[model samples]
Target: MSREIVAGVDGSPESLAAADWAAREARRRRLPLRLVHAWRWEPLEIPLEQDRPSQERTADDVLRKAESTIAERHPGLPLTAEVLQDTPVAALLSTEERAEMLVIGSRGYGAVAGFLLGSYGQQIIAGAHRPVVAVRSRDGAGGGDPEGGVVVVGQLGSADDGAPALGFAFETAAARGASVRAVRAWSLPPLYAYSPTSSALARADEAGGLVPYEEQALREALAPWRERFPEVRVTEHVEIGSAGQVLLGSSGDARLLVVGRRARRGVIGSRIGSVAHAALHLAPCPVVVVPHE
Candidate 1:
């Protein structure tokens, strides 16, 4: 089967927004767009009147509406819509394995009313084997210049660890004819603010120059990507602060914010890292979490 960009639609405005975003993305990548809606029926607890048929019909309606929305936005886009008979998280997780990327609505806290990220969205982001993008509703709440068309990616530690995310950012920028801003967040060693000697040492280190080293590291990290995407305009931003904060701030002007999630094994629960968590919850634009080693 051919890989496609999948969007999870649940009949919410946010989900519709995600479907639209997914359609645009699929077109950008020249891939097919798949709309999935998962629904499960309640057993004896509910009346027979509101049982399997009702639930199935609701799921079908949602999928049909989403398909119509996509069709209206993308007339010639190759699209498929299906109603899956499983829990929302389960269906999305299963689809993620075969999808190029999974796009879902952010129903979490923020300016948007139904934008609160729910437990299921969090679960899928934490566990998905492929890249997952959380798109907020198409209100000014997400706070991005739709015309800006800039892709921002956060790089923590070595570029090797964030290569996948960076590559995604570059590819997105290249497709959109936009620019990529690669941000690397760093901090001073501990004890620099505790003692006078430590402060002096820090000043000496600064005099000998730590900023230059950080900048050099950022440049080195992006060197290969710059060569590979020669058509892409790249900007390296080395900042002193939390990675999440920097990325969130950058999202104001970004079309999409890309971050990396380290894949963990044998973990009991959600493995989403602190940065990815923060970005998903507070990013001003659509956030894409790319799973990496």
Candidate 2:
């Protein structure tokens, strides 16, 4: 059952865009696509019978239209439509265990202040065990970079700490016949930088004394992936800066931006990592947050 990619749809243009993106990825991965429309039955004033059926019809219509849209774009993509009588977040998270990943529409800066993020949407993204892709599209613009653009992926900590993100990026690039831009952001040790000791001065003479080590670590981190996806041309970027800012800068015109998150919640506590948060809000391309150990 985990061979399928589940996409949440609510008939909104953004959700439709997400369904399209998921369909494209499903086809690329040679997997099935499942579109789920979830809505809770909560009647404030109207009668339960009157409000319930209307919302149910709306849900059916949304799934039907999504299926049509995906079928038209991705012919013969092995698609299925489902309707769930539950909250969006709970419904999607429930399906994550049976799917490879969950794709959901997210409001970007283009949307009203970029502050329209639903608290529940963020919950599902942070709580899911598998990877979750938050998509914001303009007329389905990201069909893959026409000029074989890069797939920017953040390499966190050691090579294995962020293996899931790296592997997902490489596989996606290979599918699109595109290259990968692996970025590793590091800062000089504060204790070593400001100390007025002879050791600090000597190390500073060699161009920060940390760039080469960071470069080597990044290389080692990407080596196994490079071997696994030999056809995915890789360009290593070892920059000295904040992870979020560095990733945002390198995401220009990228087909997809891949980032890592720990399953046990990030520094923000019960939310996505700072880098992933920044990326989902600011990145111009589709962003996938891969959960790792």
Candidate 1 residue-wise lDDT at 93: 85
**Candidate 2 Cα deviation (angstroms), residue 158:** 1.6
Model 1 lDDT tens row, 1-293: 77899999999888888888888878878999999999876576644465568767878998998899789868999999998888999998888756999999876555333236788888898888889989877632222224336899988777698789988888888877889998888777675465656754465467576677677767877888899999988888878888888777667777788999988755586578889888877776788999898
Candidate 2 regions off by >4 Å?
45-50, 110-116, 139-147, 192-208, 266-269
- Residue 111 in model 1: shift from native, Å? 6.5
Q: Please, what is the whole-model Cα lDDT of each candidate in the order they appear? A: 0.81, 0.82
Please give, for residues 228-281, the per-residue lDDT of candidate 2 as tens digits. Answer: 888889999989999998988888768789999888854666668898888887
Clashes of each: 7, 0
Task: List the lowest-lDDT window of 10 residues for candidate 2.
Answer: 139-148
Alpha-carbon RMSD of each model: 4.2, 3.6
Backbone clash pairs for candidate 2 read none
Q: Name the lDDT of candidate 1.
A: 0.81
